[model samples]
Target: MKKTLICGALLVFVQQMNLVQAQDWKPVEGKIMTEWTEKVTPENAHQEYPRPQMTRDNWVNLNGLWDYAIQAKGAAAPSNFEGEILVPFAVESALSGVGKTVGKDQELWYNTEFASPKKSIKDHVILHFGASDWETEVFVNGVSVGIHRGGYDPFEFDITSALKSGKSQVLQVRVWDPSDDGPQPRGKQVNNPSGIWYTPVTGIWQTVWMETVPSSYIAGIRNASDLESKQILVTPQVTAAQAGQQVKVSAWKDGNMLAEQTIDPNGTAKLTIANAEFWEPGNPVLYDLKVELISGKKVLDEVGSYAAIREIKMAPDAEGIQRMMLNGKFLFQYGPLDQGWWPDGLYTAPSEEALVFDIQKTQDMGFNMIRKHVKVEPARWYYACDKMGMLVWQDMPSGDMGNGWEMKVGVLGSQTDRARTPESEAIYRTEWKEIMDDFYSFPSIVVWVPFNEAWGQFKTKEITEWTENHDPSRLVNSASGGNFEMEGTKITGDIIDLHNYPDAKMPDPGIFGKENIIVLGEFGGLGLPVDGHVWQQKDNWGYQSFKNEEELLNRYAGLMKRLEELISDGLSAAVYTQTTDVEVETNGLMTYDRKVIKMKAAQLKPLHDKLYQVSVK
Candidate 1:
């Protein structure tokens, strides 16, 4: 968007919030106990453009306060507004301004109006959403424009025809989320909030925005790099007359045109660039992509996109021990366990700064990667990792926990003993496919973990083969931890995985084999709860608790020191538990609210740096 449009949006938000007028705009009482949360506001909360990989200059940010109502699940839209609720913040979250619950059979409604600057015939309006949990029906000017069903990926609707002749317009959304009660992939949510599951998120928990685009625009684009060929395969989605249509892809760096080509739109187009910059941990390089969909002699549409030339895989070493490989070279991965939670926003972090802060802090702490646990994040979060050059192990959210479910059940040294039923298995596949499709674009994502410790483990052989066939370029993780499926369990397609809790241990290669890359999937969950920053008042817990920061730091240091020895002894990757404090889990390097970084980043980062050096060797 132009600076003027940005200023207009900011002005609207600032005026609406009217921080000076406390009576009109105040948070729902008893929900938020911290004064620091006031910092998360409309103008500042997650203001960054949500989709960084695919860039558009004229997109609007529709975060902040919107009118919300809770109604019967199948009820029609309400004629009147109820009260204000924050966009992107889950209904159960403190920052939502509603702090309410939408049960198994309820619809959460949102209504808002927005104004856009005038544009010419060459321009069109594009309505965008970061994501909507469960099913969503969107309307503009009282006309139903579109309906989106998935809870994970992003979707956009062209609303230029639905726009008003005037300067402003109204957008209404009706959302239905059955959460875990239905057979969708809802990770760790329940009707009842307890132990590991604390509260369920309903409705829009991601950003909503609008943008102006050309009538003939680039609908979508894909950048799949071929390290072996030293080129990138660009596929731009456009409005084409027939199946054999060809689109032109233009590449640029720092606004300087480098190469151009027209190729078949059926699959990826090979664009050769001699020794083009490859993105790695330190010097990450990204090239801008511009594609024009052509029909006869006229340009039908054009879109702006970007991609980096890089690769993430796992390979065996000289001794034939499996390890993580970046660009075909063994690079041991070390990272924190990113739970992807927020004290205020739940799945959605309150601010973009907070999202990037977690990544940057992870890098600062000396880790080169992150095991993004069970939850998929907004695109911009991955963009930050790309920019920062941190590897990511993406986990498919654990869908079903079977009959016995606890929010904080102790399973530290114990084994996970849950299996997915046939019905739940189908739902798991549906959600897993959606999750993979959403995050497959990111270059930072190195591995796809389908099952984690058998939380929803079923048909592992089928899921692994499907994942491997889906994205043959990247590696597939058969299962993260327990209920070990023996089909592809021994032959590691990506990383030979093993789980360790207090003391790190590798899976016996005699049984699981020295066939592929090996990694210590999880370890080092040292918990220390800071008094003011905890999610719960009393029962907040971790794998282990500490009374002071000194003890916490000491234990963490010892854990890393042991990991350093393990790294040399065939441990290709390790993930600590976790980035920060979750609802009841206190085992995080930082506190849940993100107000406190319990350990010094300078001390932690060096530990990871050494591991990366080992991998490079």
Candidate 2:
């Protein structure tokens, strides 16, 4: 009896151990990151300066750990919270410490506290969220400050009214994410993970913090570049103390102001950068801008910003095919489809090192561009892209219903998109506009992809024209791969786009004698899951799984070599299938945990470099 009882106890202990082990992050069978992720704490997660483009030396980072609780959709904030979960990592992510999931029927509560900035009264405290997934409500000191609906864009609320002077300020965030169940433009996240359906991200999945700016500040300013004219048009949206606000602009390089000028309210400020230091995949130079918001000579606020002077266009190749060119010179763009997810932080990186590492790795491999595929990262990520000399192709996340007939055809739907109801279009347009206005300042983004493979794509011709007219300097790809229709005019876009996979091949642009600029938008997903990095056991998968590392490398090399041949056949830019494995999708050069580099540089860099060197002439 004693022996039997001892065996039962051992069995129970083994089962308990298995339960705990299951909670630990492991690399998927076909993905890479068995080792890149590290344990995070309330004190030391994502401590980097979150906002890179607009930097003020005196801002506080509210990242690290926060209390979290899952409750019913309409339930009030929980009186008591569940244990601590890492901030900026979504509840659904393993890095979040909770590894919990919430849907439309549920809401997530986040609670935290911090001391106010010095003399925060004179310095108005602005509570900022790098981003919140789906719908969000914010409370300061238990008073509701504001609520936002978009999942990907950043939002801020003036929380000074809700704070107690000099005492530690408390913040509470409530979130509801529908994932694929609603029409909020969530990319890849699905309740039931499957092929291309990634794990869901709920609640605050980005940097959360507070900034103390004066009551009257440069609320926001937009600077757009004209590659053709070597100038950047500046539009400052200032919140001056009184009427008749004016802004003073000064240009600088390496810390010295080159020029200064003043512009009245609602007027355009043109800073003509002579022989502009252009931004391209090879060389990205940003000019420092200091703009002072003034009312009757009283300097209400001064904000520092920067913009690059560069242009991306398509011109006819020697073979009569059009090729992508930057600054009127033949330039080849090669990139990975940067998914922008981390094992410990999900939507947010564990630390600034993690953020810089991805860019560094991409640069080390010698690729000059990254396609921010179907997701908008925190401003810091794009700043890294700019600082690290990586060009960007930003895609608006794909959304809208999949019930359309064109869905079966697998691209953007057509004019008669009998599928698009009135309600679906409303949410899609509102969020798309916010996304455009939020990150418009970054100089690295040369192309704005309004749609991807036709997801919720409607009014393509109209939207493309508006996008081009709104920011005429950058190139635009109207439809990437599906519902492929151009705006019946030569002036609509600068490049012709096509999608390729497993084997690298482009579509045939028929003999219209039109200048066809070809680009292989996506290709190559050779997955090899390392032993220690994976999200889950049953769900993770890749487009093409390989038996071993050597096989994966050989296949990748073979695919890239074919990409080079396509470049000679008019391919100007090529985007690989992924940056890293996420959730159930194991097709990444690096594993999800980011510990392993699946393909060696000696084997892959030569091929990528060859793509950049392929002559369009």
lDDT of 2 by residue, 1-617 (tens): 99999999998997776455344523222233323354455556667767665666667888766778998989878989986777777887666667777877988998878876675447687888888988899998899999898888988998878988665888888888888888778877788876776778898888887777886776677877776677777888755445677888877888877767789756667888766688876677888888888877687777777877877776776667676778888778888898887655667776677877888888877788889988998888888777767889998888764634343233222444325667777777777788888888887887888877767777766777777777676788776655555445242355556665677766553431155566778777767776667676665687789878988888888887887787776677888888788877788888777777887666678878887777656
Measured with C-alpha atoms, the lDDT of residue 104 in candidate 1 is 67
Q: TM-scores, in order shown?
A: 0.88, 0.87
Q: Which has the greatest lDDT?
A: 2
Tens digit per residue, CA lDDT, model 1, 1-617: 69999999999998766664333544455532333467776556677778776676666788877888999988888988778788878777877878888876889889988885467875777788888887889999988889987677788888877877886788899988877777667776778776667678778888888877655556667678988877878876654335545678878888887778887655566777765988877777877888777665666666677777888766666666666677877677788878787766778876677778889888888888899887788998898888889889888877655633232123211234446667667656776776677667678888898877767666666778899998887788777754444444465345556666666666654444366566778887788877867666788767777888888877877876777677666777788888887777788888777777888887677655665665322
Worst 10 residues of 2 by lDDT: 25-34
Q: Residue 541's C-alpha lDDT in candidate 1?
A: 69
| Model 2: per-residue Cα lDDT at residue 17 | 60
Runs of candidate 2 exceeding 4 Å displacement: 1-36, 120-123, 164-166, 241-245, 295-298, 403-418, 486-495, 510-516, 536-540
Q: In model 2, what lDDT does residue 394 have?
A: 90
